[model samples]
Structures are given as C-alpha cells and as structure tokens.
Target: MADRKFALGTFNAGIAPFPGIVIDDTVYDARQVVPHLTVATLLADWEASLPALTAAAARPVGGGISLSGLRVLPPVTPPGQLFAAGANYRQHVIQMAVAHKLGAEGADPEQLAAAAAAEIDERKKHGEPYVWSGIPSSISGAYDDVILPGGWDDHDWELELGVVIGRRARHVPVADALDYVAGYTICNDLTTRSLVPRKDIPMMGTDWMRAKNFPTFFPTGPFLVPATFVPDPLNLRIQLRLNGETMQDSNTGDMIFGPAELISYISRFAELRPGDMVITGSPPGNGSHWGRYLQPGDVMECEIDGLGVQRTRCIAEAD
Candidate 1:
C-alpha cells in the first residue's frame, strides 16, 4: 500500500519492545495502525498482516520516532527455531578444506579451486544440506553487544543471509520452497572455533551447543525485508567489516545450497513454522582463514542487498 518497500523491526522507547516499520529512514510505530500486532504475531499470520502494514506505512505520523540512538531489538525475538546451514558456500568450503589440509598441499590453487567447485556440484546433485539447530536464547539484536565467552580465544564471525519462514512448511519441494519464506534478514553466526570439535567425544564430532549457543552469539536483524522485495536471493552481495576493515566479502551466488534447496531439504525432517529462521551458510573469509579472531571492543558491520545492515559491538564476557 505504501509507495516504497516495507521492513519490520522492534524498537524500545524505554519500555517493552514494540513492532515498528521502517520506511525510508524513519521508524513508525505500527501499533498506531494495529495496536495488537507484534513481530511474532506478524510472522504467525504474515500474509494477513501485509495489507494493514502497508496501509499503516502510508498513514500520517503524529509522533513517529527517529531511528537514531534508539534501541533496536531482533526483528523476531526468540524465533520458533533457528537452523543454520554449514559448509553450504562453495568458496567457503574450499577455503576450509584447504585450511584443514583436506586437499593436497602441493596442489595448485587453480586446480584445487576447480576440484572444490566440482565437488560442490556433485554434492548439490546428490547430497543434502548440512543443517544445525541453535538455541533461541543465543539471539540478540543487530546492534546489541556480543559477549566473547571466557577462556575462549577463537571467536569468529560468519555473516549470512537469514531466511525467515512465514508459513508452516513440511516436505516442501525445491521449486515451491520460497513460497514459505516470510522475509529475509541479516544474521551474524558468531562461532567459538576452538570448542567446535569435542576431544572427549571424538566420534560425535562438532559440538555446536557449546561452540555456537552462547548468549548473544547470534546477532540478527536491523529489519526483516519481505520476500517479494528480494527478487533473487541468490544474487545478493554479502559482506562483513570488522572495525571498518572488510574481513568477509562474497556473493550469495557462491552458495552450494541455495535458499530454496535448503528450505526444501530441512522441511523433510523438521516442520518450519512462522518466525523460524534458516541462516544460509556464510561465504569465504572467516577469522580462521585470516588468522584473526574477534577481540573485545571490536565492532562488526554486516550487510546484504535489500536487507538492512547490522552493526554489532563485541565485548568480553564477565568472568
């Protein structure tokens, strides 16, 4: 209904979080249009709320708040379930393989890259995505501070395109998977690389709970841009900067498993509900590759096309 696109976010004006819509640069409290609408409720009935949200965006603002200096919460607090795709980016997987010596040391970079690309193609043809679940408590707002866990020295950043599920999805086909997506957002899948593979449980392998589920480990959302606005999820640019230095930069096209395939694959085993998030894997250029880990007082700014930017400050956890 509004002339421009719409995005959803939660803002605190000193009290509880309230649903707000971002049009241009200002945030209009959506309660002025629909008093009962919250981020969770909007996702639960996303399609039904669009009309009212659009109308609300066009209405006159009597006391709309400026976004500057305001506290912005995660668009969807305590999302239904958070699913993260691992090793889903072609270049990132190649980088990891080479870094971990999965490929021969003497092999040429071009040859290795070719081999990696071939491997990814084969996997997409016959393999399924690697999906891992994260605790809801790990989520924090896009602008919130990230706490570096005590005794951990390998904290890393993995900027990703976060897909928000709008409808209940089970056994969805790849062709129709995007239909279930409510919108898209930005998510920083922060990791404690040292705690990933457990030595105590060698056979069990990765311990995501300990490595990825710390409080504020997942910093997400400046706003949730509707799916319709994002014409092609695979063509977006994804980048992250650490204290003004660009650390991770790549395109969504590098993904081994695109958003549609990922949604379809995950739905086979788990029912994706509204407000649930599927974080498409991050691109190449992680701290491990650069030999630089996150430090206290470091700021991370991540952005994707259409989706708003997320600026997060890192701090050390209290001992």
Candidate 2:
C-alpha cells in the first residue's frame, strides 16, 4: 500500500472542467497522463485506470499547478444516477422523531432515548433502507455557489458520505457490495423541507424530487478518495458548519445502515452503474432541528475525513 493515497477531482483551467488528481496543495492534471480520460470515464474503467492514476500521483510536481485560484468542479459530473438514503442514521431518525413529536409525547427523556434505541435495533434486524433517487442536474461543485430557490424557505443541509460505484451491479449482497465501490466523496444533501410532504395528496407521502432536485441542491466533492484508502467509511467524522457556527457534528458510525447495506439494498431494485452515487444518510443535527434554515448570504462548510472539504455560499435565486 502506498503511504500517500490518491484522490480525483475536476478543475477548470479555462472553460471546461478537466479531471485531475490532488497531491497535497497542488493538482497534477491526470489528462497529462491519460489525455482522453474524463472523470466519468475514469470511474467507468476504474480498475484499469488505478495503476495509471497511482503512477500519475507519484510523479513530481514540476508540471503540477498550484490548487489556489483553480475552480473546482463536482468530482463526478453528470453522475449516472443519484441515490440518497433517508433517515438512515439512528440518531438523526431519533432526533427528527422527537423534534416532530412523532411518538414520544409526554415521555421522559430516558424513556424516549430508550425507545429510540429499541426502534433502531428493530429496524436493523428487519427494516429495509429508505432509498430515493435524485436528478443529476441538481449537482454543483464543492466550491460553487448554492442557489436558494424562490418561494422556498426551509432549505436545510444534510452532509453525507457519498459512495461512487465503479462497476455495474444488480442484486449485490451486502457482504460483496463494497467490492463494487470505486471511492468516496462528500455530498451535502440540501433539502427544501417545506416541499417534502404533498398536502394535495397527503397519502402519497414525501416528494423527494421536488424537495431535493432543485438546481445546486447537492454540493459534492473536492476530491474522490479511492475506497481502498478509506479503511473504514463508517468511522469517518461528518461535520457541517453554517457561516462560522458548527451545526452538524457526528460520525458515520451512527448510521442505521452502513455503505455496504445501503448499496446492497438499492442494487436489488436498480442496476447501479459506474459513476452512480449512493449517498449514505447524514448523521444527526440539521437546520430543521435547530430552527435555523438556510438564508441568502450564508456560507456552509462541510467536511468528511479524507474526502476533503466543501465550502458553498448561498445566494437567492435570480429573477
């Protein structure tokens, strides 16, 4: 194993975004080594390109450009299909339930906590993951500006660990699912909470597309760190700060369903292709819980260990 791990990202030197590898503070253009490889193509043939990418990362920084001032693009552009797990973190689910007064009304804190724990354990034993799809067009660069859509007031952030698939997979078992992953990245699953439930058709339940697929709703990547380098994805810390205040701070270990379980569950119904992303659910602590929804001119910084940081500025939707 190499002492230094490899990460892939897109940088805009001119007009178009080009695939590159970040080595420390400098970016070595992977196109220099494989001129025709786009980030999508690299992921499509991840196993074949691993050697070349590793070699490219080991090369000297003579031709590498400083990362400063370079515009970063979403690591995976036009990802094949975006999947998100909802209420997949034990604590997050508990927090939401309690905050909304779902079941624990008038119960003491101890009883509420115990009941939540029991429910989590029961779900782990027999519950299937709650997975939903998102439009690829919703994706934005890690450092890009997030547009707060007009008429929406409850935009909230859910920073999650994003798993990028390296191969086509269908009906994959949990034990073997991790083998299909290419790498991990950071994704802030922005949501418009007000649009969640369809009041017109209350029985129809949540409308993820309307709530999550707005332009620039999903802010992803600074880099895609290969799965091999991430020994334990569940052990990584996930944190999101609003402006300068820390809002979300938790670890992936709190997830109700880990990456392997999430992939296996989703692959049973959908054929996950190369460049398809499955965002493992965000941990507890979101604006909804704090009554601090996003406002224009706000800045959000999200970070996951080894996957790199994303800084996004919020601005009102243009007329």
Name the candidate that leads on TM-score: 2
Per-prediction TM-score, please?
0.95, 0.96
Tens digit per residue, CA lDDT, model 1, 246-315 = 9988999999889999999999999999999999999999999999999999999999988979999999
Candidate 1: Cα lDDT at 245: 94
Question: Which whole-number lDDT from 0 to 100 does residue 125 have in model 1?
Answer: 91
Candidate 2 lDDT by residue in tens digits, 92-194: 9888877776665698655776788888899899988889999999999999999999997899999999999999999999999999999999999999999
For each candidate, how many residue pairs have backbone atoms clashing (under 3 Å)?
A: 0, 0
Backbone clash pairs for candidate 1 read none
Name the regions of candidate 1 deviating beyond 4 angstroms. 1-3, 35-37, 104-112
The clash number for model 1 is 0
